[model samples]
Target chain A: MSRQNFEEQLDGLHRQLMSMGTLVEEAIHKAIKSLVERDRELAMEVMKNDQLINQMEHEIESGCFRTIALQQPVGGDLRRLGTMLKIVTDLERMGDHAVAIAKTTTRLMAEPYVKPLIDIPLMADHVKAMVRDSLNAYIAKDDQAAGRIAAQDDVVDKLYAKIFRDLIEVMSKQEHTINQGTHLLLVAQYLERIADHVTNICEWVIYMTSGQKTDLNK
Target chain B: MSRQNFEEQLDGLHRQLMSMGTLVEEAIHKAIKSLVERDRELAMEVMKNDQLINQMEHEIESGCFRTIALQQPVGGDLRRLGTMLKIVTDLERMGDHAVAIAKTTTRLMAEPYVKPLIDIPLMADHVKAMVRDSLNAYIAKDDQAAGRIAAQDDVVDKLYAKIFRDLIEVMSKQEHTINQGTHLLLVAQYLERIADHVTNICEWVIYMTSGQKTDLNK
Candidate 1:
């Protein structure tokens, strides 16, 4: 393939990745919305849309493989392709977590929440921003932006810890709260994990830009 | 690089992956042992050894990148290298889940038995088997074996559901068990996630051998 052709293909893959990122962000949003509002239909929609994200991941993956094989890209070009592969995997996993949140919503649909959902949405907002920023960093190859995004994980962690303690307290005091409380705990955990995936994306962006594998998750 | 040299390099990378897999398996064992026996030292060991797994992932990743760049491998060789890159990621994640389990163990070290740790260890046994078999499928390029291993995930899921219910029941009956119960629930969740990663490996193995993307997770 010509250099121009290869560059175009790479650009196309980036566009697909961005689209996939958008879908993932929406999934997270809708999953949390479904939970906070007790909207089963929205939850199901998030679950259904996860298939679209998975399909996009497979398509981008095939493109990456084809470009690498045909162009035989070296150094920076190869790193970019490899990073794209990893990014899609992260995005796909984020989509899966969103679906997990949706599933939790479904499981708790018939019953009232143990408590009014507050910190969980806050956790979701932080993760959504991390997701958006991580993708932007990937496109710009901004390692500094990636570093900043990773640092935001600390906030998500703190929110999760607070939510965990609060839920444990509620569940202990009320026998009926234990079931829904545990499910809520898992939801918070899923968001925290989504944040962790953002960090992985940040790490990959750093690797793609500077060729250094930094443990930004630490 | 000559063909023989490239083959040798690939073999070395595979050896490194297997060793990483071995470390992951051990980490899972020790993490559960720590939880079951309330062995804080064992939990600490699992946390420390995770660094070794992370280091191995980086080394094998670099080796795979170098081989792909130097050899410009096409067809099966390229697919094999790509699979190795992904396999290491899955293994590294399984290591992280083990570490999460170890962290849970550390948090609950002061607590007495909420129930015997029977089901959690049983879940771990299933996931550990999935890990070992997934790697064997990769080495043999056995898509059929991959399919079989993916089938095993059903067992893990059922086990997780059982554990979830059991823990919820115990916590509801005994309010004091709430904190430790939640942690044990997460421990079971970490094991379930490890099995999911094993399914991911199986999917990659099938893709490597047959050039098809399969959603074995469903």
Candidate 2:
């Protein structure tokens, strides 16, 4: 294959990966919304759509392998393919975390509000932005952009700390809120981890561009 | 490098990877035990050991790349090295999850327990077994052993469900149990995740040996 065709193929794979990212990010948002709104139908929708996300992950893996075997990708191209493979694995996992959160929401629908879920959706918003920016950085090959997204992860981490503290206080005050409060805390943690994964992807983009590993959070 | 030398180096790399896995498994067990026993010192130890785990991950990645480049490994050797690299990444993340749990335990030290933490420790024991058995299977190339460990992950999942339900009851009965209950719940979720990762490593092992990707959970 000519260089142009190879470049185009790589671009196509990246586009597919972005699509997968978009689907997962949407699933996460919708899943959380389903839980907050007590919409069983939306929760079911997220669960059913999980198969599509899984299939996309498989397809992206195949594309990476094909690129490796056919193009014999080396240097930056090699790193890009490999990084995408790793990043997508993280993305698929983030989708699973969202599903888990949605399931918890379904169970808690009958319970009274221990507290308002203000922080969780806020954290989700940050996580989604990180996921979007990480992919955009990869496609743009903009390490600066990736680094900025990674830096924002610390904010998510701090937000987790606050959410955790507040949940503990709520549980301490109302013993009945313990079970539901724990589930809410877990949801925040899942979102925080998704953000961490996004930051890891951004780190990979930096590695791909500069051939040096640096933790953007520091 | 001569073929014999390359083989020896590959074997050494595998041995080192297994040793790293051993260290991580021990850290996870110690972390959970510290929590169950409320041993702050043990929790601190787990925190300190996490740095070594991160270092091992970096070392393994570099070693794999060197082996691939220097030996130009092909066929089975290449696949083995590739799988090791991926498994190490999962192992490293598992270590991080353990640390996350340990941190939660330490934070909950000042708080009161909602219950005896029976299910939390039970869940941790199962996850620790999964890590050990999965690594052993990888080292022995025993697909049956790996499959058994993968199948056992449901035990942890079931335990998590029970624990979550119990904690919810505790919270509802006593408003004050919320903070401690939530932290304990996070610890449980972390263990569940560690088991999931162990199962993932087993899947990779299956792929490595049989050149087939089969979901052992099914």
Candidate 3:
């Protein structure tokens, strides 16, 4: 392939990855909303959407292989392709976790309430933002933006700490909320992890551009 | 580099990656034991070992680059190195999550308990087995074993479900157990995540050998 053609193909590949990211972010938001609202139909929808995410993962991975084999890309281009391969795999896993949470949410549909769904949803919002900003940083190659967004993961960490404390208090004081509280805790933990994976992708993006590994978490 | 020397270096890289995997598995197992036993000192020790995991991730990644650049390795060798790059990243993330759990366990040292630890340790045991078997599959080049181990993640999934139910019941019956219940829930979630990442590495191993993607969860 010509250099111009390869560059255009790279652009297209990035667009595909970003679109997948947007789908995953939407799935996460909808999955959390479904759980908080006890909307089984929405949870089911998220589960069904999981195949699309999986298919996108397969497609993106094949695209990476084709770029490597056919284009034989070297240097920064090769690194970018390799990073995309890793990023898409992480994004696919993030989607799977969302589905897992949705499945649990469906299970909890039969169970009674525990605490108000405040921290979990708030953590989801932050995770969605992290996913968005990380993809944006990748598309734009904005290491500064990626670093700033990555640093915000500490906020999710703090939220998790607070949620742990609050849930423990609820579990200890009341017996009725135990099962629901645990499910909610699991959901919150999954959201925190999604944010962490986003931070990881941002770190990779920084490495791709700068050829220097950085801990964006700092 | 000469082909003979290149093979030797690749062999050394593979050995190091496997050794790193063993260290990470030990870290995870020890981290969980620290929590289950409430051994604050062991938890701190696990926290300190996080640096070694970080260093190994960096070293293996550079080793991959050097081998690729010097050997211009092709076909199975190239894929092996490529897959190693991704697998090491997942292992590093698993280490980070183990460290995160140890950090939380340390914070919970002074606190009172909600329920005796049962499911968390059980879940950790399952994850450790998965980690071991998956890495074994990678080293032995046993796709069937890797596939079987990957499918075994459902065991952890079911354990997570049972644990969530049990914890929720505790919280609902007594309000005071909420904080402790939440921490236990976080611990279970971390173990579940560690298993998921192990599955990912196993999938990469299968892909590296077979040149075909798979859904190990299925």
Candidate 4:
């Protein structure tokens, strides 16, 4: 294959990856909305759509393999393919976390929320933004921007810590809230983990561009 | 390079991946032991060793890239490299979960036992076995064995649910145990996620062997 065809194929694969990312971001939003609004239907929708994300990821992954086998991609192109594969895995997992959160939302629909889910959504927003910026960093090959995106994970971490302490306090004082509070805690934990995955993507972005392995989480 | 040299290189990389799997299994075992025995030092040790796991994973990943670039592997060989890359990632995340569980163990050391921790350790054992068998299946290229290993994740999931319900009961009955009980819940969660990752490895094994995308988590 000619270099132009190879570049176009890579571009096509990347576009598919971005589509997977968009699906993941939607799942995250829909799952949180289900929790905050008590929408069981929306939660189920997120759960069902996870299969679509998985399908897209797998398709892109297979395409990647065929391309690599045929073209024997090397150097920058090789790193880009590897990075996309890694990001696809992370994105699929983030979709699963959304499904998990949505399932919890369905489970908790009967019980009144122990507290307003203000911080959880806030953390989700941060994670959603991070996911967007992480992809942008990869597309732009901007290591500095990737570093900045990874640093934003600390914000989500701090948000999760605060939610955890507050939930513990609520659970201790009101025994009835223990079940729902723990469920909420898991939701926040999922968002925190999603953000961490975005950080992981950014880390890969930096590595792909600079060939330097840096732990942005630390 | 000759076909023989390529096979040897693949063998060397596979060996490195198995070493990573061993370290991950040890981390999971030690983390749970620390929790079950209330051994703060062992928990700390697991946390400290996470860096080593991370280091090894990065090295293997870099090597994978270098080999791919230089050798330009094709066909089944290329998929094998991709599979190992995916497995290496899951193993590293499992190591992180162990560190998280160990950190929770240290945090809960001062508290009294909520229950006997019977199910949590059982779950850990199941997860450890999955990690072992998942690698074995991958090494053997036995997709059926891989499917069986993924099926065993249900055991861990059931154990997690039981632990969750029991912990919730204990927390509701006694206020003081709420904090420690929740910590225990997180530990169970860590183990459950570890099992899920083993399932991920099995899924990759199936993919590498059959080129079929399967969702073993369902």
- Reproduced native contacts, each prediction: 0.76, 0.42, 0.47, 0.89
Best by DockQ: 1
* Per-residue alpha-carbon lDDT of candidate 4 for residues B1-218, written as tens digits (9 for 90 to 100): 78888878888887888898899999999998998899999999998999999999898888888788878888677888899889888999999999999998889877779678799888988999899899989888999999988999888889999999999999999999989988899988989999999989999999989888889997
User: TM-scores, in order shown?
Assistant: 0.99, 0.90, 0.91, 0.98
Of the candidates shown, which would achieve the greatest lDDT relative to the real structure? 1
lDDT of 1 by residue, B1-218 (tens): 79999989988888888899999999999999999998999999999999999999989989988998999999999999998988888899999999999998888877689668898999898899889999989988999999999999999999999999998888888999999889899999999999999999999999999999999998
* Cα lDDT tens digits for candidate 1, A70-95: 99999999999999988899999999
| lDDT computed for candidate 4 | 0.90
The clash count of every prediction, one per candidate, is 0, 17, 29, 0
Each prediction's RMSD to truth: 0.9, 2.6, 2.5, 1.0
Alpha-carbon DockQ of candidate 4:
0.85
A40-132: candidate 4 lDDT, tens digit per residue: 999999989998999999999888888887888888898989988898999999999999999999999888886678999999999998988
Query: Which lDDT tens digits does candidate 3 get at residues B178-205?
Result: 6666667677777888888888888888
Evaluate model 2: give its lDDT: 0.80
Regions of candidate 1 where Cα sits further than 4 Å from its true position: none
Q: Give the worst 10-residue stretch by lDDT in candidate 4 chain B.
A: B108-117
DockQ of each: 0.87, 0.44, 0.48, 0.85
Q: Which CAPRI level is candidate 3?
A: acceptable
lDDT of 3 by residue, A93-177 (tens): 8998899799888889887676568888989898998999899998888888888889999999999878866865666666555
Ten-residue stretch with the least lDDT total in model 1 chain A: A109-118
Candidate 2 docking classification: acceptable
Candidate 4, TM-score vs. the true structure?
A: 0.98
